[model samples]
Target: MLTNKSSSSSARLTFWLGLVGLPIGIVAGFLAGASPLLLCLALIVGAALLWFFTSFEQAVIGLLILRSSLDLFSGLQLPSAFAIGINALTILYVVVALLTGKAVHTDKFWWFFVGWVMMQSLWVILLPLGGLGMGAAFLPSAIKVWMRYFSWLMIYLLVMQLKDRVPPEKLVSLLLLSLVAPISVALMQIFLPASILPSLLTAQAKAGSNVSGTLGFPNGLGIFLTMFIALIWWKLSTSQKRLPWMILLGLVSFVFVRTGYFTGIGAVFLLILFINSTKITPIRVIGVVLFCSAFVYMFGSTEFGQQRLTEIYQTPLLNPNIDISRAIILSYGDGNSFNWRLAHWNYLIEAWKQFPILGYGLDSSPVLGIKDFRTGSGFAPHNDYLRFLVEQGIVGLLGFVLFLTVQGVHLVNLLRSSPPKSDRRNLCLLLLALFVANLASMLSSNIVDATTFFLYWWTLVAIAGWGNEYWQTHRLTQSA
Candidate 1:
């Protein structure tokens, strides 16, 4: 009884409605289930529905996964069985995608493969007995290796597909929100009689004794907020971006100061360099004076600021007392920890002689072994490059160097070709901030262990691709 046009309209409406309904239903069903296995299945179903029905679903999922990853160090509170089940679900999703021929392709496959090879290379290089002793001694090494990179690959694939769908503004918004959400929640928790705030502080402080900030020892969160502020400050000052972000940054800074995390002070200075770099005359001088005065006032406070101030400049290594008032310095005028880094680097450098090709399997540090290193609570080397050298040997390190070098060169070229006043300029600034932040994190903390490392690398690359596309489109439009 209906015409063809009416029939088509009905089908389209039904399809659109289903698209919205299915994802909600799938996610709800998954969360509603008490059984871990059933929940995992529901997550997979939700993943599939989201992937198929939404345009920016990949980016959304990627961000969700990354946001969830802060839990990597924070206890999941899930049973071991449940964790394994989730891993299985992830694997199943990948396999299903491949079988269904929805497999995303990328020219960057080699770079991804190199990442895997680097992990495998660890097996042969670091272990003294050529990794044979590792399996018998540490069966869990295999699982740990998978845990580090599997989700990363899936996220990369998802990003590759959804790169264009995630606008630059939205990307910026997500980061701002990540910082704001935690700060807001933590602030409220401070007033409320909640068990979470105390527990969180205790755990995070133990992980790194130097942490001090409003959200309990704010090592991770502080660094994260600082980075976001830098990015947002640049965007807001340079472009007509949203005003809420400026307000958000102010709130975050207040929390950082209130927490007494001295590291955030350094991070704020680093951010200021980019934001106020152009102001060269009276304002710059005034800013510097104000900064120094504020720093002194904050440092002078005993009850709130003393603990953080002491941790800020306290150097490890060479100092007999762990709580030295000032950073220890060697006779050579280097920070004592600076000397230790050189010493450890030298040790790894010498060890590379034995296995120049494949060094050692994943856990090269003492924390992974039976005994802790002299450095205290030993784990992997704090330096990402050194860790790679120790674990994967020269071969894997070489591949990584090449990959990063090419990416760097590409970024430089892109920046040079684009106009300074263009929107694409923000990408360049973001890249610069990330490059500096990651470099600093590598020098100070174990970058790879922090959830920051994986997210930073993937997000930078995705944004780079996004910028490249925009540049190309702009050129085409001008030509037309």
Candidate 2:
């Protein structure tokens, strides 16, 4: 006598219960001296249950949380953990999307980008097979490097599926909330003695060195915060609750400066200038002028800041008397970070000459036997563009450039097509700012190597996509 709807609900409940209980039963049986095969079966069943039961939203949030929590285990240096977690969650999300019949939405340009990436990956893989094959010792690392690069595509696909389910604003809010942990860790690092801090939350730093926060490197933390400063400032500008947002912005900026990353500081200044140029108003102009004045004053007041500013404007490279190549080699011995980078760049440029088309394959820089003047060993060039040039070659670099260009064009279109003062336009502008800031940071830091930074970068891309789709849908609905 039960209704059809009630019977269907009961069936669904029973099915889920069985799915959950089966894994537990398998685990219990294994604990009770069951065959080793039972343990393997349990693992498979558990993985399948996790994949099937986890919603897309949950997977997205879980990925973000897992990335944020990585700094807590910095001592382990477990990048493999990040690679595995991200890949697993992404695959699971895709499987769920397919099962739910959700369309994998993407534009023609995006498809082309994906196809190009695949081709580059294939070339890198086959390059070794075609020539002096990849060393057995280097094979696993090479595969990992490719996986890390490919993960960005997976992230984009997963977020695309959730474009309608998750709003861009909510994603940004989550990111803002995630900042709390790192900021708090930074604050503790500043206040507490190094010996007193938990090893997991602190890293090796020079005596009296600036706080690095959860990222473990002071410059890295500065670069990370710099990427978000413009976006936060944008939010501050649009927000009604000015006092709280202003306070938060001040706190983040204070942490940013304390990291003592001169490049990051310069990048922030450039971003401010860019924002001001985009929309010049009387009030905005005044505010920008005041900000610039304060910025100059703050740096001028401190000897360290003044020295950094001087280095930025007048490095030894500009001197005609200094032989650039000799100076670069000497810089490694002189302990000058800037000069060391120049030397690395020089080496990488020379190395690129050997494999100009496809390069020496992904992650080949460390093992390609190029001499590192600093440590008497091979090392990755700190500059990302050089890394791409040496590792992936010209073809890889062009593919990357094209991808960025297409993304930039799409963002610009979204910015222009959206109504003035609309959420979509605002979000697009913020994403653009974040993208430019990260790109600027790449000159000095291989920002993409860090999993957290990777997450932040691609999440911005996803949010931009979300904004575009949301706006288009709203326009169509209104017209209809």
Regions of candidate 1 where Cα sits further than 4 Å from its true position = 1-74, 77-136, 188-201, 206-217, 238-243, 256-268, 274-357, 368-377, 468-480
TM-score of each candidate structure, all chains considered together: 0.65, 0.82
Q: Whole-model lDDT for model 2 versus the true structure?
A: 0.67
lDDT of each: 0.52, 0.67
| lDDT (C-alpha) at residue 425 in model 1 | 60
**Candidate 2: where is the Cα deviation over 4 Å?**
1-59, 75-79, 127-134, 204-207, 293-307, 310-314, 317-323, 367-377, 467-480
Whole-model lDDT, candidate 1?
0.52
Weakest ten-residue segment in model 1 by summed lDDT:
471-480
* The candidate that achieves the highest lDDT relative to the unseen native structure: 2
The candidate scoring highest on TM-score is 2
Error of 2 at 93 (Å): 2.8
Residue pair clashes in candidate 1: 122-360, 122-361, 123-361, 125-358, 125-359, 125-360, 126-359, 126-360, 213-259, 214-259
